[model samples]
Target: MGIVEMNKDGNFPNVRLLFDNDTGIDDALALAYLCACDHVQIEALTSTPGNVDVEQVAANNRALLALCERPEVPILIGAQDPLQIPLVTTPETHGPQGVGYATLPDRGTTASSEADAVDYWIDAARANPGELTVLLTAPLTNFALALRREPRLPWLLRKVVIMGGAFYYQGNTTPTAEWNTHVDPHAAKEVFAAYTAAAEQGLESEKLPIVCSLDTTERFEMQPEFLTRLAEEAGCTESELVLASDPEGTLSNSSNPLVRYLSDALRFYFEFHRHYDQGYIAHVHDYFAAGVAAGTLGYQSRPATVDVETESTLLFGTTVADYRGLWGKPANARIVSSNDPESGFAELLTRLGALARKLDTNS
Candidate 1:
């Protein structure tokens, strides 16, 4: 089942959220979507090393939050390296700065939260047990560490929506692994084991973790035409003008900061996909993960005993879903198989357009 059901008014309720990100292009876009959405109250942001170093990710988080006018949200720095393996970064996909072509304005002297990320996570869980949902859009290093500090963390969290792994689809990092999981397969393994242990100890099935793997996420692609239509609907004059002049380079000279930033960031992602997958579009992987966290997306899910491969050299980091119950273990996670992409994309654009309108007027 999904994280939440619709209310009598057919609307999802506002949810409190904690975000952990590596701040890549898609992560930035997801953050923008979450900040703009009224249905989620972002409690805090935690940074980890993945797309770039932890330091750069933290900086990107601060800058992006400032741009979204959400600098008040606590930014906490977390694991700088993986639990066991040396940290690997993907600067090639996301520009040298890890946020694509867009250069976010300096956030000045603003600093991140003094509280350690692990400490903050434990405290947040204690403060709002069974109420805080976590959106993990990066490696599982920080989360694994948090669980180590407080073994009861899985039981304390209301839900977890992970944007990692590749079950049925080909891996983006290696022949059998996704980037986030591959970056720190040991951590991923530990995390899955923790949840499995929690379930064995009698945590409710509904509270089990949910994963949005590459198989489902790769289905939602953002086309240029859709983005242009959204810009027009949002009345983004700058974006419209840019789209008119250089439709392909809509990121250049757009008056709408959000449009300009997102367009620029997406350009790099689009180019990567076009080169690798022969598609002139970008996948909304992390964005869909955020939607799941917000309980605003319709999807099909199956409960399964999931694990990460950490021992095999070639297949390390591969997400193994025991569909046949060969392991004879109780299900520990919900694997999302498919989603209503059309309606989901529509809702995404509607919310983004509303944010654009708000930013346009405020600017």
Candidate 2:
């Protein structure tokens, strides 16, 4: 089969996601979470050069899908560079291959004939009408291209859940901007303004198009034992494997290729957590964003007159305006701040076990 065969309804869900990944540990974790979730049907994946090169990002994506036993899923290669600015990468944070020290498989074949990611997105949105949700995790280049192809897209998409921007939160890339949004501020502005204006017009689809400068994913942290369990169940039970992807001590720019390889790198990725953030493991931020895309989690949202200030000295990029009082403007996006992490993670680990067994048998 084809993606169509996997669609539960006659048509795919409005939840069409686009990932311009750096191939970091969270990206892999997010991809695995999306694949394992039955509710979220990924229609397409698009890679960009941010943390890892475009080729490696694509390769990592392939290895991940194969590891999940869903290589048949379609993917489209994305732009080699950013929309307007020079490519900025973070090898120190995302590691050499973009994940924790992990291994990747060979790239076999293109999963889709729609090679141009922007065109693929445009066609998908047009074909699906008001049912296409664009979940962007990395940058906004692909989204900008899509809008350039069809100006009405901001109004047409079911929603756009973006995992970018830094509000009161300190920036991971710089003092004021987040990596994803800062990479392409022009594209971010277009997307932000388009969706904001559309919601002001009471467009139904715009009611949830723009999720703001929010990162609610800090709530979902997996325990060190959980990471050990995932690797152990994966048959790589050595404590070394656990230490490698520890999310703490694992250097973002490890020289050992196999240390951050996607296949067995989860340990080092987890180890990095022990060094940077609190505890031995980091929260699943992007993965939780994927959960919102799957509709598996609940959200509480309020409408506001949102704007991106192009002139803030500190926030040289755009900044969403202070939450204004109740206006007729619709809610183009939602923010999910909490979840049953214990139960949800347990469910995810359980599914991983089944998937691991399936891969083992097939191998």
Candidate 3:
């Protein structure tokens, strides 16, 4: 299927994206990467509660958009808590504010009280069928609710890229579950089941969701040197230095605002990883997901009949993928199996650095 649309003047193809995330450090990086890309038009942002609370997530998104000079983009708050589960915010992982140590500029509320995220998804899909790609970097809460209201979502949108699950890999949240799915495994299960139902209704297998599980996403690591290179690319007089030897919660003092914001954010991530003995590097899970959604990164995937385990007490949120034909089920997702981390990081640095340089020039 043609994922992008050509301009009316026959110039070039462009992508229209609807972004959903919880606005953690990696999610912020992902959003920044998308904001930097010149070929994609961000239609709107929908915030969900995961890394932090819903209100804080919306504030973080609005602040990031303002920093990117796209504050006019609409933002809607998603489900307050995961269905059938209490809300669990990870301040330990993402700091109290969910953006690590970075400070947000626009702290005003952007949560649309009257508007609902599920309605937004359904309406957007109905209005722009075959022209919208949804990048969901959070729990499957909102999208799952939308699929309940509109079961044809599997065939309505061009693509659905999700950043969750940990098939055949160690989880970051639990021994068998990723954070996003752990927060709302029931929602995930419903999403996959809906897709399976749609497949039975003649939705092509290629239209299934693309799953960016932790097994592949963890490959995209972010070293501190990348930030230094990005600062230099943005023509900052001060190099962005985030040494592991520095104290916890160190801040960035780069000349460029974008570099400084990112430096502060990634510094906390480096510290978090180091605290857990995972080295001073950050596993940029959502940035890879963002690249996958943007169609700017190369990856290999295999079709899998995916399911979520919600009833097991010991395995509360485990994601099970039937790679073999033993399940006798239609494939519900394309599990990303492999990716090149070196090239992914390079692409992120180049695009974000260019945007930073442009912003600096305009300022």
Best-fitting candidate, measured by TM-score? 3
**What number of clashing residue pairs does each candidate have, in the order they appear?**
0, 44, 0
Please give the lDDT score for candidate 1: 0.83
lDDT, candidate 1, at 184: 91
Rank by lDDT, descending? 3, 1, 2
Q: Write the per-residue lDDT of candidate 2 for residues 1-363, one digit (tens) a residue.
A: 101111224333435555545566777777877776565667777776666767777888888887676777666777777766688776666677777556666556553322477788888878887776667777776676677678778666676777766555666556766667777777777776666666667666334544524444555776656654554555543432344333444432322222223334555545555667655666566665665566654444444444444555677554453354464555444433335566557756765555554555566
lDDT of 1 at 343: 80
User: Clashing residue pairs, candidate 3?
Assistant: none
Which model is ahead, 1 or 2, in terms of lDDT? 1
Best by lDDT: 3
| Candidate 3 lDDT | 0.87
Q: In model 1, where is the ten-residue run with the lowest total lDDT?
A: 240-249
Query: Where does the lowest 10-residue lDDT sum fall in candidate 3?
Result: 1-10
Q: Rank the candidates by TM-score, best first.
A: 3, 1, 2
